[model samples]
Target: MPLGADHLIHANVVCSDFERSLDFYTRLLGARVIGEVFEFDAGEDFMTILGVTGGARCRAALLTWSDDDTATYLDLLAFADGGGHAARTAKDTGLARLGLRVRDLAAALAWIEEHGVPVVGGPVTLTPMPGRQRHVVTIRDPDGTLLTLMEFPERR
Candidate 1:
């Protein structure tokens, strides 16, 4: 069945700490919370929706970028029990990465460095079109989730 969808409404990033995740996305990447943080015992429906059989407690916050052209929603979730496990980069399969775009790639990478976040790799030029060149970088978030950041180069 082809599910007709408008666009990606939100993506979930399970974290170990709500504050840390919030700071990482909001403080670091400039995403603003769209709604209040929700806290409750992870009911059967929640666990089911998350594709899990257990884990009863969860706290989640909806996030969106202020500078983003699209809504670009992200849900920063903190789950209890094994749900709070740090991200794994091993070959074990799952949602391995999340991509993001920023206005100033260099400054964003610098922010990651200044804040002591692990950089997966240095920035590389993407589309080297004159007057519209682009760059990309890979880095690890607070929970080790890999994120790719892209931006247009500054004209000098």
Candidate 2:
């Protein structure tokens, strides 16, 4: 039996510049900035659970889409002092990515370009693994995290 997971809670991404990341996700992806938190003191304990002996002293923003009621989120984190690095290509190992579904590929791409956000690649159509044809555009967030906007052919 499959695990009865309902929806995603959140994905944490470390950013080199969180403010920039926050602006980008809101302006470009239309995510609602829900809240922000700064880690300190025993706050480092959480990191220890992840095996990072030193607790992180970072500021993070919780973002979600406007239509989302479940409150699923993407947490953008900027670790203390040692800012995070830019995201590598999607094909690169150990990299995490989020693909968002859009209603209109062309319009979405146009809106994204108008925002002056960097397009990492695509807006190209492909019959990739899911076996369904999809129109896709890959973009790099201000902190270089890879996000793909996807438009799928409506089912018959």
Q: Pick the candidate with the highest lDDT.
A: 1
lDDT of 1 at 130: 56
Clash pairs for candidate 1: 42-56
Please list the C-alpha lDDT of all candidates, in the order they appear.
0.79, 0.76
lDDT of 1 by residue, 6-25 (tens): 78777888888788888888
In order of appearance, the predictions have TM-scores of 0.81, 0.80
- Which pairs, if any, clash in model 2? 44-55
Off by over 4 Å in 2: 1-7, 35-42, 69-71, 83-87, 129-131
Backbone clash pairs in model 2 (N, Cα, C under 3 Å; residues 3+ apart or in different chains), count: 1
Q: Can you write out model 2's per-residue Cα lDDT over 124-143, one digit (the tens) per residue?
A: 99987667899899887776
Error of 2 at 44 (Å): 3.3
Off by over 4 Å in 1: 67-70, 84-87, 90-92, 128-133, 153-156
